[model samples]
Target: MTINLTLRQLELFTATMREGSFTQAAEKLRISQPALSTAIRKIEVELGLTLFDRTTRSVQPTPDGRHLFAVAEDLLRDFKVSMQGVAERASGLHGRLTLAVLPSVAASILPRALMQLQRKYPGIDVAIRDVMHERAVAMVADGLADFAVTTRIAETAALAYDEIGADRIHLVCRDDHVLAKGKGALPWSALEGHAYVAMAGSTSVRRLADAVLLQADFALQPRFEVEQIASCIALVSAGLGVTALPALTFSMFASDRLTMRPLTGPTISRQIGFLQLKGRQLSAPAVALAGEIRGAYGKR
Candidate 1:
């Protein structure tokens, strides 16, 4: 036979069993004692089971009542949990957010944005992949990441780009280095004789640097090659070599031993922004995180 007891009946039944008195259950449920008894009686009638042994002095659960109560307790607990999850999803405060970013941006801007994202959506789990700018865009197109914070590219038919901010290129060198001897901005030609710490050829930064130098008819004198921006900055900080990077990168890897000088003679800058799949709809968490990134950029 199918049981037709309502959730209200089950709740009243459980409350009556727990309190062991109709008067006490009514007090806990903020209802009249007669109403509590009527609800529990409806549950007992629908289930065709005597759920309680009523006495003048005391009320106790029967053997069937004890077994049903155990099962109902777990059922109600799980139901409450499921409803809470639904609420969190409706509020856009649950789920995982995956993002790909250039190593420079991951270091410089992502941390602060993520911290803000966390505060706004504490139920969200964030995963960050710090890769080259090219890979950052590729991951978003390939569905490996929800979105990317990276520079623009010529080939973006499969992706959508939103320009959030632009970062001017700068030269990073040791404080006592010869290039740092002069004040104000330095020209691309000024880097002619310096030992350059270049990013690996696979990186977008390296490509941009090469193209800019080539356009200026300047030869690249590479002294060291590294993949991570942090490594390049560390090498420059140690007075090993000078490197060109976005001015925004300076704040993340800054050191008292190293300082940034603007690059002139056709000053170059890259547009950095959000990259997402062209037709795919972003999840709520990803949209929220994108807002955080944009807000951080606006503050800068």
Candidate 2:
């Protein structure tokens, strides 16, 4: 037969066993001695076992009572621990957060934001998937990530975008490159006959670069096409060719080798923001981390 027991019953049983007297246990539990005796009698009837040997002078546990006491004490201890963990998680004091972010934002502003998050909520663990803009958006849409920090590439019914800031496109070249010798912002015409190191056609940077080139009516073709930002920076640093990238991504390049000049003659920029599922509420830790990100970008 299945046993039916409430926490209060277990608590009373353990307390009476510890005190060695129903009168003393009831006093400790703030209940009448007769009420405690009735509850214990009900427990004995349900278990179909005699739990205590009672006399006018003393009360003592039988083998069955001893066994039940041990189990009930352990159960009460475990329940207390479980409840504490639940409370901590609900308060954002302990939990895990997963984020999908563009490599540009990951390298530039995300580090500072994470530092602040850690200081405030040290018990929260974070996982980051630093990827291109497209992959970042896909992760959020597919529920593989809690949220994303990336540029808006398209409107999707599954995702919501919150624009935080914009990163201006800049022309990146080796320090010795002719374009780098100029002082101020360079016009699009300056790229006319130069070899271009283009990012892979799939990247958000490449898409924006292509749009800007088309708008300027420039017909230059790429000399090299690379998939990673590091590769593009390496080629430019080696004086192979020049490439255009957003200002936020410039953090990955070594300043001693490469120089970035703002692109003008109709300057181009991309919106950077948070991407999360529509109508989904974020976890407390996710909300806290997003606040830190907003603070980091607000300064810029």
| RMSD for each of the candidates | 3.6, 3.7
Task: For candidate 1, give the lDDT.
Answer: 0.85
**Candidate 1 residue-pair clash tally:** 0
Question: Per-residue lDDT tens digits of candidate 2, residues 120-159?
Answer: 8899999999998878888988899999999875777888
Residue-level lDDT of model 1, residues 1-300, one tens digit each, is 887766677788788888889999999999998888888888888888898898888888999999989888888888899999998876669988789987778777888888898898998888989877877877887789999989887755788888898989988899899888878898999988888999899877788789899889979789999988879988888888999988777766757888688998878898898888888988888888889999988876
Model 2 is weakest, by summed lDDT over 10 consecutive residues, at 250-259
TM-score to true structure, per model: 0.79, 0.77
Global CA lDDT of candidate 2, please? 0.90
Candidates' C-alpha lDDT = 0.85, 0.90
Q: After superposition, how far is residue 75 of candidate 2 from its true place, in Å?
A: 1.6
